[model samples]
Target: MESALSHRRFGSSDLMVSPLGLGTVKLGRDKGVKYPKDFTIPDDKAAADLIALARDLGINLIDTAPAYGRSEERLGKLLQGQRQDWVICSKVGEEFNNDSGDSHFDFSHRHTRQSIERSLDRLKTDYIDIVLIHSDGRDEHIIQHEGALEALQQCKQEGLIRAIGMSTKTVSGGLLAAELSDAVMVAYNPAHQEESPVLDYCARHGKAAILKKALGSGHLISEQDPAQAAMHFALSHPGVTSAIVGTINPEHLRENAEACQRALLQT
Candidate 1:
């Protein structure tokens, strides 16, 4: 099979990206919360090695969020000198304070600006490749969040972000976002096929559709053989430009890339 990373293009952006993007949600959280058993959060050095390895293997797009504990900061430290070559996508609207406390969502213009600034400081980058509004699939929130949307547009105009998008959990929310934003990151997989029509709608409007939870948040890939099957199903979807997979293990990353190639061939 050919290298899946060679399969590129993210929406209408000129930036070419790997079909399998790196998701950094786990990187910011404590291992206990993310995984049931004992799992180690890799140190800065180890994480840097993983980042270097991923780039070496041709994986370029990295998705992270401020809500993910120290992920943006850790990735910033790991990719210190070579940030320009990769596409860094981060989300705003959610904030993580303490591990024990409930997380909060603030999509106001003030909070949006503050969130983007904090992310930039943590990422050590002047401009983010993409900044997505992290919405939890609530129509009321979308309808009431005009200020945040305006702020995001302002940020784009100011050159703080290359593209604007929304990360949604529902097909309707994704469709709504696709109508307003330049791209969308949605939970899309064979297990949840309802979002396919939304993806197609996004494609028709020239908006990029980025797949999240492509492996059902690790459930689909809990077994060895099924991992490839799940990934193939995701990449084979015509509406998806790339599928973001989260894994600290380099071998699993390679498997995802291979699965993408198989999907491309079959499609």
Candidate 2:
């Protein structure tokens, strides 16, 4: 029988997360997404069902952020009784202004600290498993000038977050994030392999590397199912700890999980 993929220890953190983390961007916002297709936002019940399915399929890492519409709130409610079953990861520095259908980022110390506090309250939890900086493509500046990293490190020290990381966008930024953070999220897909060096560095340094947009953000060019190929590519790299993919459809969830299983077998 096919089963959910195995887990990996996330960097130096105590968190042992699933190899395929469920990204919750579509759970909260569908208005200004980069998905090739558009679909209606799922109701709270639907969201709960998908989360339940994920858990049933052995997905333990749930990735969310303030920029992902009401995902944090929805997850707070949907996962009320089963909080311990999953390791929740959220982000700071970016906010989705639903009114304007636009986004704004604030990496100041005050905002960074306040956002973590707000996330705690919204998620109905006392602590977050992982907190990453939601980079706005300006990864280096955000990591340097902005106080986001300091705030996250402070929160980590205070026990507000178990681990600190950055969703970096560049090779240099990824390397820097790995040097400073316990985990670093990078974009890697079959079409692009430029970021492989970052992954290599992380592997050598014992830092966790999380892969984002592994399937080209669901904009795959090939007609065949890319789930297996994407998972293969993601896990093929020794540095990658996990791949985060956002999908609301149950079929996609099953397909992705099975593909991860097959990829693991191949490896």
Candidate 3:
């Protein structure tokens, strides 16, 4: 199963990525999740199968974060031989405490550098394709006051990261991130379009816009053909470089990939 999905330029970066990225939040942690139902963490074999299935279905991008429990560590083991086959996107600024089932935020210069270094070791990679600041709802403050993205820029210059941006929670933050970085992860779906302006800005400025919660974070599951409908709506926008869908289920992964291919074709 060679990649059948077309690759798109990730903003101004040298790397090309698949439009449908595999989000790995479910791969590591189950507690503190907002999914419609609770799920058990998959074992090693199951995790490996899901990763392989994603590659076979033409997905080349994998999104994980330090807040996503052991996702980076597990991926480090699972992707040992196929590192170059995927464009890995990890995050900093937020750390999940497994013991407390809570998350804490850190946007300082020193913490930013340490986070990236830890991610590189956890993923067993020399460099990450993209590293976004996992915002803690204070998008404006984080960009303007916290100086997190600036730290990421330094890492990029040092060749530790290929691209930098923020998973912004607001339109203003999304736009600001696009202005300062190579890409942004924005939440956009039929149920919520408040960040469409961010997408428009990305389209006009040639910045990469990766969609988060494109399926309404499973809230849209009741809709008919939810995966196809959600994916089509998200990718129809010329601004969206890719949409991250976090599903450990093989059937759902295939459906999402097919839906994205159809949407890209129509576009």
Candidate 4:
């Protein structure tokens, strides 16, 4: 029994993701985060339970990255039984050291291919639903000079990735990425609206635009229900395919989903 909310499609890609994808950053990395409060990473049981809850709540998209502590690995194990139910979005280029909490990125041909293969192994999946270049603020340089984008295209051709995109930093880079990739993840919230141009491009082109940091990465703390407002704003945009919101707490996850439900109903 799939929730109707899971049936929304992302442009021409085969990925029919949920209108509100669940972000798994809090599931993996707690350090170097923008969350207002500190939290211990959930244990394996808790993680598995949370994924199950998300599915029951009609969320089909799960965003993960190697840069997140062990999110891919944990999901690999936790989501073992029903692989078809999820549209998992993983990343390349950035790898975080668990012990040091430090990160390094590589977008060369060799590394990009190697990283995707490793991601497939870690995710315990035959093919990843989406693979985004986790840009390090050098969005244009990475897309133009680096071999990552080319590798992703090759992977798509080889049937390893369903779609390819970039979690872009700059507007120009985002526009370029929208031109080249299947999707683009941009940071757009009420507090920051710099990426509207990118959203506009995606809408105009029928490319998928996934909004990240919709709640300002937990920094937009005010009493006016910022989470609801942010989700509404992100989805209200014609270009936005879905809003990715991450939370470790089951209660918070449900609350966020309710907010998304409200947001979707508004239009």
Most lDDT-accurate candidate = 3
- Measured against the true structure, the TM-scores of the candidates, in listed sequence, are 0.92, 0.97, 0.98, 0.97
lDDT of 2 by residue, 134-164 (tens): 9988989998898999989999999999999
- Local lDDT at 133 for model 4: 98
Enumerate residue pairs that collide in model 2: none
1-267 in candidate 3: lDDT tens per residue? 534788889998888999999999998998799999788889999999999999888789999999999999999999999998999999999999988899999998889999999999999999999999999989889988886888899999999999999999988888888998999999999999999999999999999999999998889965378888888899999899999999988888888888888888887
Q: lDDT by residue for model 1 over 1-267, one digit each (tens)?
A: 334357477778787788889988667776224443455667777687778777876789999998888899988888888987689999888777746645778888988999999999999999999999888567336635556777888999999999988888777777888888788888877687878877889667778889988888766644456767877787776778888888888777777777777777788
Candidate 2 segments whose C-alpha is farther than 4 A from its true place = none
* CA lDDT, every model vs. true structure: 0.80, 0.90, 0.93, 0.90
Model 3 TM-score on a 0 to 1 scale: 0.98
Ranking by TM-score: 3, 2, 4, 1
The candidate 2 region of ten consecutive residues with least summed lDDT is 1-10
> For residues 1-267, what per-residue lDDT tens digits would candidate 4 score against the true structure?
333464588867877988888899878898887778889998988888888889998999999999998889888998998999999999999989988878999999899999999999999998999999999999999999999999999999999999999999999999999999999999999898999999999989999998899888888866888888888888899999988888888998888888888888997
Against the true structure, candidate 4 has what lDDT?
A: 0.90
Give me the runs in candidate 3 sitting further than 4 Å from their true place.
1-3, 221-223
